[model samples]
Target chain A: SQQGEEDPQALSIQEGENATMNCSYKTSINNLQWYRQNSGRGLVHLILIRSNEREKHSGRLRVTLDTSKKSSSLLITASRAADTASYFCATAPSGGYNKLIFGAGTRLAVHP
Target chain B: DAGVTQSPTHLIKTRGQQVTLRCSPKSGHDTVSWYQQALGQGPQFIFQYYEEEERQRGNFPDRFSGHQFPNYSSELNVNALLLGDSALYLCASSGGTSGRAYNEQFFGPGTRLTVL
Candidate 1:
């Protein structure tokens, strides 16, 4: 079964707009990570936020995790057309192997 | 350093036939994992290999078996393939550690397997 589920299956916005995506999970997790994938390409690891951490930032990518709610969100600020891709949230279950369970991803379209 | 690499960017096979997909992990990485992604859906975990052993497996059946070489590269073999088995096969590499917090996995360009 899938552990994480992302909301807003699709989103479209003009360039320079910020894109935010949400992910909710069922079970307790040690960490939540986000990835980006271009069409017909491999997934690129973006950011990882641990359970102890509330928020993290890498360049223009910002991620927040709320263990109390078992949810997390990814924010891409000042989005550009090159940022158009599918974003996924993955959860590493607590007290188990570090295998990552991925969510069904949100597709973002940045129109230039 | 090269990221993960997969062979045969695309392949075509018939139902009931067998297929073998290969992957080479990133340099200095010892763990390899495989995933299957269908159209319009997220990638599903197939199994993971560590130290040349099947460390953990997903809900996939026995038909989907894999082997990891001493060098850490791995192969995913699917026997008696079905049409539904056709999907993009992705390979990811990471260091083998249990509780080290953030261990980001690097992925390879997936192999598009088409079953006819």
Candidate 2:
């Protein structure tokens, strides 16, 4: 079973527009990380936000976490055509092991 | 520094046969983990190896096993392959266990495995 679930299975937007993807998880996590994957390829780590932190930013990427709600959201500002890919949210449990539990993911399409 | 690398970009095996996939961790990394991603789904954790020992595992069956060499490279072996076992096998590497520092995992290109 998957611990995290991403919403809006798919999304499409213009190059200069902003894209937002949401993820909800069942268990408590020490941190939540977002990754991007091209077709049939491995994942690239985007950003990681710890449970203690409410928000984090990297370049044009912004991530917000609400531990109380057990949810997180990733926002890409000024999206580019190259940003088209699948985005996955993964959660690392508070303790036990450092393994990551990933969500199905959100397919984002950015058009020029 | 070289990133994580997996052997045999692609492979095919029969239903009753077995297959072995290899992975070399990135420079400065000491831990390796494996994942299986099916079409249109997220990657599922298979297991993790550190210090030449199996540290943690997911809900996979005993048929899925792995080994970590002294050099920190690893291999994933699947016995009695099934059609449902077909998927992209991904290998990720990270630094050794730190006291809850939230290490980031770097991934390899992955090997596409198909079972007939």
Candidate 3:
């Protein structure tokens, strides 16, 4: 199983505060991706970090990948009430047909 | 320009019954994948289709099968459905096998399946 496990299954924070989520997976991977899912809706792609990349940033989101430790982290600076949603980390294992294995996800609640 | 699309939006079925869910991949995408997301859990890979054939599959039972048309549209069929089969069926699309090293998948709204 190439599934990733996210730490802190849930998180609650106030508006304007920062939120960080971690994920760990087994087996080597080609890349890791982050996604956000709203209540009763499908997931939206957030970012992708390749195995060789250490860190990348987009807008208010910063993603760090530590291939040596088989882990990754997502940092969202200045979160808003609309940022409240479930965050998932998915891994595309190496040598596979590009199928992604997702983690259980972290449910984030941002209080306005 | 269109993202992946799935239908019908919602479905209800009983045990031992059969159901089929449909999906249309994003424009210019030649690969389609299906996932089953149970409550409180992440989406589990069901299978992936490319060139109108099953290129890869997850550890699902034979009761769960699929077919991809030449148009890049796909269908997931589950026979003898069980209560545990209830979940959100998501359809994702990407380029083809020769795509970039990191082929980003675009997901659809998903079809909610409820088994009684």
Q: In candidate 1, what are the lDDT values of residues B43-89, reduced to their tens digit?
A: 88998888888988899999999999999999999999899998999
TM-score of 1: 0.97
In candidate 3, how many Å is residue A62 off? Answer: 0.4
lDDT of 3 by residue, A1-112 (tens): 4379998899999999999999999989999999999995898999989999999999999999999999999999999999999999999999987899999999999999
Provide all candidates' interface root-mean-square deviations. Answer: 1.7, 1.3, 1.7
Computed on C-alphas against the true complex, the DockQ of each candidate is 0.67, 0.72, 0.70
Best by DockQ: 2
Worst 10 residues of 1 chain B by lDDT: B96-105
lDDT per residue as tens, model 3, B27-111: 9889999999998899999999888889889999999999999899999999999999999999999885564345888899999
State TM-scores per candidate: 0.97, 0.97, 0.97
lDDT digits (tens) for residues A1-112 of candidate 2: 8999999899999999999999999998988999999986989999989889999999999999999999999999999999999999999888745688999999999999
Q: On a 0 to 100 scale, what is the lDDT of residue A51 in model 3?
A: 93
Q: After superposition, how far is residue A105 of candidate 3 from its true place, in Å?
A: 0.3
True contacts kept of each: 0.62, 0.63, 0.67
Give per-residue CA lDDT, model 1, range A15-73, as digits (tens).
99999999999898878889999995899999989889999999999999999999999
After superposition on all C-alphas, the RMSD of every candidate to the true structure, in Å, is 1.3, 1.1, 1.2
